[model samples]
Target: MGGLLSILKGGAKEEEPIDIPLNFGAQPSGPEIEYYNAVAGLMRAAPGILNDLRSYSGCGEAIRQAISNPGKATEDAAWAVVCPAVAKLKDYYDFSCALGNAMGAHAGADQQAPVVSPTEQLFPRILSFLGNGDASQNFEQSQALARKLAEILDFATQFDNLKARSASQPAGQPATMSNPNVQNDFSYYRRTVSRMKMNNAQSVAVVSDEVANKMSLFFAHSNPVTKALIDSANVAVMSRTLSLGGATDVFSILAGVSYHMVAKGRAGNDSAFFLRVMVVSVLLYDHIDPAGAFIKNSKINIKASIKVIQSSGGSGADALLNALRFSTQHLNDETTPKAIKQMLAQ
Candidate 1:
């Protein structure tokens, strides 16, 4: 997280830290005006969108079918039943809030503007459309809509957490919930491998060899429990290492260990749930961080960092950072044009 902060800060040169009073009441600028316009467009369409939704065949049919249970009915309905309507509503609220911000700026009430508590927060001035309903009914509808949206947006895909758990266990050995101390298992190997290249682990082969040597040392010992633990960890690590050892393979085998572990159901069963959280933590780190650069004169190579991010589906922060890093490092590459760099920065 600190590394991410450094990278963000690195984009700008150091300057005196000046303490400026923040006036929440300050007026907004042209870009903010455009932002409000976009939001207003969406907001103004809310009532019509909701009306369309209410009359839509699917929504009407779903509602009728759900007569037995409104709660269950909401769960089964498509986004058409709620998304367009609620999204428009949310847009209206956002626009009103933004307008209030713009007004605040005009008043120079930036920091002094009163912060409304959740319960005390009044309905947006534009959402008078919802005022026709009884308070109890309106609240119910809002709650239902919120619940339905939550269901739609829930990223049911189980990737990071599972891999972390699988990695935690020693390679080749199936990790069980009963056995807590699994030694230097797959998880250990994953952490090791991720650290290896980032910190410049001598070579991929060397990292693997080290794991093997450590396993050998563990097995050669007298204690059965210790040997078994080490052996299990070795197996887990080896599986990931082999798959991720290739030059073009950017996916961190170590990171994927968690995914596999979660799939194996070992993640939730763990005593500490450390492995599960670690997987997410790694993702969070990768998400906001810029790909570290190794710039020497004109030569540029984003191969290492870019590959890692691309292998992970290319949506993470590392991917974006890597792109920026590549552009920054090679801005003056002999073959490239300055215009291209300017275009990319835009």
Candidate 2:
């Protein structure tokens, strides 16, 4: 709350703006201009998307307020802000998935000189994988990760806890959790909460009162949303469903349970759908991102969740994994070690 975000806001530094013509990696040729134009249109529309991205700010703000003010009113305000933001974010996420899908189909169609796909645009490094017109020569470090994701998504799609409601045993998924209780208390099974201290909201936000107040300062970088999600997930009594708050990050719970219940799917409804996309997003983020401190020196746990998912695959595993791979194929980030290393690769 105070350190990272505040530093980002308050740290005074002088910088000179480079007046340079920027293009999205396009040469000033024919097709390149076409691509650049598309990118420009996207850039023009970026504000709306950016707004959606920053919409999480509301919850972030509410999180800070809850920590600083500390009261029932503050807690309720946080919940109100967070829930709606999550709902809206899910829709935006769905759109991104659809865009990724279209990107893949198009890229696949062109074998010889593959045209750049939108997926590659978001994650430009993927374009580097096309190889020297030879599949064998391509950069494929992610295949190992992809196959693992495929298994998980495949497992999730087949798992339909609602099927149990219809009759008794659902054939789609005969294999529930070997230890269902693991989902209830992720920490008992997987250890992601070694450092995070929690107070009980005892409500949906999951923790509140004097407990949240006293320790608020220690957790300034994180919002109450994270604490609630982790706490609710740790002791959730869900079945093929998880506490809605866990949508903050499914860790690997979505692998077993398709969606989050409120009050849930392999993506049955919006929340499920959102979580489905989010699971992959977090996993992909973990696969490439480092164990070192993120931009904010933030305390959010990214690696532990994927460690669980990769250890035991999840629903729509193959499809989701494929979509994500295609979506991010062209993506590049110099900030990530993997990408930097790849750029240096011969």
Candidate 3:
């Protein structure tokens, strides 16, 4: 009976079992994931790709050099080197455009972050202003400057907040006011503002009469330190203008103003009042253009402007101004006038 049962079990099991194969092919990725992956791959591949292109360029340059020298190399040999380089260059061009288009499409779809250029990354505030349209582009240019001013205000707010928090804390508890990082940041802020004040003073010296008047008006109700800086700048401008036979070249004035602001920021004395003046002056200068204001029939909003300056009290403001400076420096003179026009329109 045991043997019969074992035979029956074996026979039942012997019935052919069906084997189903499972396919685990690649799954489709989401748009965002695909974009991120593409970006990551590009980032990783960029250095190698650039290096390869450089090598090709070098090879082409070497061939060109050889061809230029007398009896250095035959034309056919040069052509061999040149032709391949040219072909590779064409491939690179195609690849670059394709990648750019892909990235742009992804960004347009809001599926991925916009790919920032090296220059834009270094000067992020300028990114806001980069546009094809006149009005939109012009509006973007001031964004950095405005943001910087706002940041300065934020710093002041932060300090005030810290003070308030400390005051509210238990009497036996330690205060954040004593934190080294906080103190250092505040010190940095002071130094940065002092520098800005020096720059504003310098710019004030070289600006056009109309601009100077506007600046004076802008600072009329500002802190005493700002007023003092403006006075000094005006004196310098008067001397310089007189020496130059009262030449009011807008470009020269702008250049001087920009230079002085940067220099002052680098070398000015650090103080809260000085910092406030610096921030206010720089922002006023950036926004206050006689030509633009005249074209737009606009007047400076003193109360609003004052509020902007007061509120700008953080490290982010400094970063924004730095970016604005970079953008301004890089922009062409022709474009600058247009940008100014746009600012005035606002």
Ranking by TM-score: 3, 2, 1
Q: Evaluate all candidate structures by whole-model CA lDDT and list the values in order.
A: 0.28, 0.29, 0.29
| Tens-digit lDDT string for candidate 2 (230-259) | 222222212213322222122222222222
Q: Which runs of model 3 end up more than 4 angstroms from their true locations?
A: 1-31, 41-44, 54-73, 102-346
Quick one: best TM-score, which candidate? 3
State the lDDT of candidate 1 residue by residue for 184-244, as single tens digits: 2322333444655687845333234433443333222222221221222222233332111
Give the TM-scores of the predictions, in the order they appear.
Answer: 0.15, 0.22, 0.23
Please give the distance, in angstroms, between residue 174's alpha carbon in candidate 1 and its true position after superposition: 28
Deviation from native of the Cα of residue 346 in model 3, angstroms:
29
lDDT of 1: 0.28
Cα error, residue 52 of model 3, in Å, equals 2.2
Candidate 1 worst ten-residue window by lDDT: 152-161
Candidate 2 residue spans exceeding 4 A from truth: 1-29, 32-34, 47-79, 91-346
